[model samples]
Target: MLLQMKKKVLFILISVSFYCGLSQSREVDSLKLSLTNSKIHDTIKIKNCLILAGKYGGFSLDSLKKYTLDAIDLSKKNNDYLLDGGYYFMGVYYSEIGEINKAKESYKKALPLVDSISNKKKFGQILSAYANLLSETNELDEKIAYYTRALKIMESIGDQSKIAFTQYNISNVYRLTGVDTLAIDYLQRALISAEASGQKSLKGHILNNLTIFALKNKDLEKANTYLIESENICKETKLNLLCFHTFLQKGRYLDELKKTLEAENAFLTALKNAKKRGAPQDIMLAYTYLGKHYEEAGHAKKAIQNFEKAQEQDPANAERIMSPFSYMSWSRAERELGNYKKSNEYLLKHVKIMDSLNSEKNKKSLAIAEAKYQTVKKDKEIANQQLELKDKASEIQKKKTQNNYMLGTIVFLTIASILLVFLFKQRQKRKNQELLTLKREFQIKTLESLIEGEEKERFRIAKELHDGVNGDLSAIKYKLSSLLEMNNKVIKEAITMIDDSCKQVRAISHNLVPPSLEKFDLVEAADAYCANLNELNPSIEITFQHLGDVVDMSKKAEVNSFRIIQELVTNSLKHADASNINVQISNRNNLIQMTIEDDGKGFDKTNIESSGIGLSNVQSRIDYLQATVDLISNEAGTSYTIEINKETLNGN
Candidate 1:
């Protein structure tokens, strides 16, 4: 496709040259001749060709300059939003020629037109071009502002491909401003977005830029990854441009890695590739890099040769290109070649250009400031007018002749008296309603407390019957069998039956209420339960620790706390298959802290919330006591921490 474009461009140049030779008048004839070029027929194509021609052609400049104005006028006549784009391109060309005022004027004209365009994708693209033009001179803030606007628009439109380009541009601005980490973030985002969009071409470009950003950030791993991705994309696309870029990037990465031989090879490949493509700009860059590589390797003479080759390829580029960045390579190369005077000269020029770029940027900033001042002034005026209009309306109402002061006073007093009586009645009604609500709440709490007390009493009685009476019954059966001598098989069987019945009854009662927990305090209860648990599961190990002096808690708090602990221990012993458990109790700053940790097969919290009945009961009981419980469980283990305010426990 590029070959086809080259053929077409050649044909147009030849035709225009032929026509100009035949015409008597050169200027008018050259203009007329240019009209026949396909680049002149389509405004979009013409704008693109003008910019491209500026980079390559000598004679194309005059024609491109003329057609740029023509394109702007045509766009306006056609009501095309692209007129803004044309104006931006013209600004770029003028900047290239160092015509600051003309460039500024063109950009000013483009500004509103670009804003008026409703298409977000095109808006983003045009804004990016405008930003790039600003960045050309050292208008750092303006470049950032415009690029930010473009990025936001691209992101809003979900134009993934264009957004990647914007990200790269933002990264460049950050890098120039000495924010390497921020630059890396943007460049990485650009690479990811570009790759996700399946835009291999854009991916390659972002990858190369990201590599540079990472290198600046001193992130060799990130730089190498991006370089590899860039190289792969370049190979896939057969993009010689990207190959040249990534090779240079890899050379820098290798240099940072201290692999000088690999770095040198990469640099040589980049230089060879750039030369093969006949891209003077890229070749010059490659030569500058080679100079740096040689200088680093202690080959000063070879470094100077490479620097000279770079300068020879693009000497005029120092002035002809608006990019403040262009001088960086030249300045470094001149310095290392021991041309201190020339190096300082280039460096001063570079700095001056950068400052001028900043000044131009400041002018735009001043313009924006002026615009904001006018906007605020206009808003104030509008507000003042509105205020005056309101005052006038009030005055007009006041001017009405009716003055019924006495009548109004009488009516107002009567209304006030009636409203006072009505409000009093309403307040009385609300007070009565609140009293009724309080009574209902009190009754509910009384009923709840009574039910809870009854349940506890029943549990205590059941435990006593199981542990005390059932144990006595089993002993009695054993004593009777001993009294009968139990030599006969029938008598022995009957004695075993009685013992089994007693054991079953005791188990049932223990299930109804744990006997040890009822008889002991929280700490003793927990220790005794863990001991019983360890006896039941000999493989399990349980450790208990107590801190602070034990305070006598109310019976309700004690029962609830004991029941919760018992339920937890039972679940751990039965289902957790826990080999090691640690229970800690402490009191600090008027709060009780109980933490239970276990190296168990932890259950998923979500699954437990959905399916675990025992956990639900524990959580409900804790919530009723106004205590806080936090459970952290993963594949490795389970941890439960319960915190109870000592005040809440004491109140019970």
Candidate 2:
């Protein structure tokens, strides 16, 4: 019965994989038919060629290269500005095939024409592709430079999808280098841009990678959350490859969590799915994982069987499928099964593969050294040629100088006489303007420094009150509790007074610096404050709504924004005597928009002086953030709106 259940589950997974593959194949066929049947223009044909190349990239290297080359030739023949795009695709294909030198050359050819390309979107795409190739070569610095350049171009063009794609690639590189924090940061940025651009496929990819990163970080809960989201997206998009990988990752996570039975079932399902799709590499990986599980469980015979199956499914280029580890696993299983000879044989094979890999690495190093030598030699030749040209030019310049000296001296004197007088006046004006500007700058800086110092002191005092004085008072309270056993009225009264004082001190400390503001973003901090308000005043309902994506901002902006919202909410709860308070924070056109509304008796706009220190603090924070504020108050209710530009907060 258990076997039957396992077979049924495997069958279902295989069926799903098959359906997704069929759907994708049908789409590709439809696109091909459209290209063949239509009388497409040259530009359209070139685009179709590029699309076909990308579609074939994973399965057929020959076809991919052929189409990419055709696109380049056709674009050149037509004098189309998308020639750079064609070269970009060609570079991608070469890089995919491990032709690093050729790929780099193709990328170099494309970059010069990127700015000249009529389509800025395509130019940005090309730059991103080039950067990806650079990443594969281990040229991380150059890769980042190209990615940054691509980001600027994409942003300038307002191509959100390309921007997301570029960010995703950057995150991948960071992840590869083990920079988990930066990787997550870029991935989050990519997610925002992808969702905003309605690029569900790209968003799904980012989510899937994020799941892997979270798993690496031992954040199982976050990993599972990201995995579920990615799975949903893959199912919706019918992305068979991503679905296969997601199942594998899920199985690995389950295995790590010690859910052995569930992990085994997942691995079996992944194996079936990969077999259904004819993905040899994934099939081998699934079998390898299953073998490892069995080996760990002391099922030597079962482990050996699975390892053999993995070996059978492994591709010709087994190194690409982690062949060394697979071989080691096989050797271990064989040794456990008492097959000494076979274990020794597999071990030898593993060593041989490693040695061969090392040899290949050495050869690659030698090739790189030779290439560098040739480059240096060429540079020297170019330098010598430039020196010759410079010497000849210098001789000609000397002759020209002699001939023009008498005439030039007179002309120079006349021009200098007029220029000196004009420059003197311009200098006087510039100096006066500079002095005024410097004075204003000094005043602004001084004010900013004072505000910063004040905040720092407030934080210091708050920490001392909480961690020092408050701790001592708590200890004293504990001691007083012991005295309570005596049942003395005087002791009880003293304890009550101490408790009240402690409460007041705690409140004062919190007022100095809200703990939430220090730890959370503006939106989260505000939500926390509102929750606290609801707890204190059950009659008043405070609702918080965050729309769109909220990215991380500068600390100053976050702190000031939290303070402004806190002050507004407090006023509404205490002075306004409001029954319902609504707060909305949203991102629009790269600006943060915050709105607070309360249903309560409002004051007149003309009575600004009537408002207390809370309103003044709000204005002060707004000025610090360089944000715009609008307030509307009436007999019925009051509403406050603030627009904050993030660039201004970042000191752009």
- TM values, all candidates: 0.39, 0.45
Considering every candidate listed, which one attains the maximal TM-score? 2
Indicate the residue-level lDDT of 271 in model 2. 75
RMSD of each: 21.2, 23.7
| Tens-digit per-residue lDDT, 1-652, candidate 2 | 1111111121122112211332444466665675565576777667666666655543355666777787888888897546766676667656544465787788778778766447676566666766665532346556677888888988998878778888887776665554569988998999999889776666766777777777777989998998888778777866544565667778878877988888788778767766654545556677887887787767878888888787676446554444566677778889987899999987987898788667755654555466568779999999999998998999999999997997799999999999999999999999999999798667557646766787899899989998999899889888988988889899888889888778777866876787877887778878877876676678999999999876467777787777778778878877887899999999877789999999998877777676652477678677767789999898789999999887766343
Those runs of model 1 whose alpha carbons end farther than 4 Å from true positions after fitting are: 1-117, 135-141, 258-261, 272-281, 316-652
What's the lDDT for all of these models? 0.66, 0.72
Model 2 residue runs over 4 Å out of place are 1-30, 38-43, 55-83, 94-106, 116-118, 135-138, 258-265, 268-287, 297-317, 320-328, 341-652
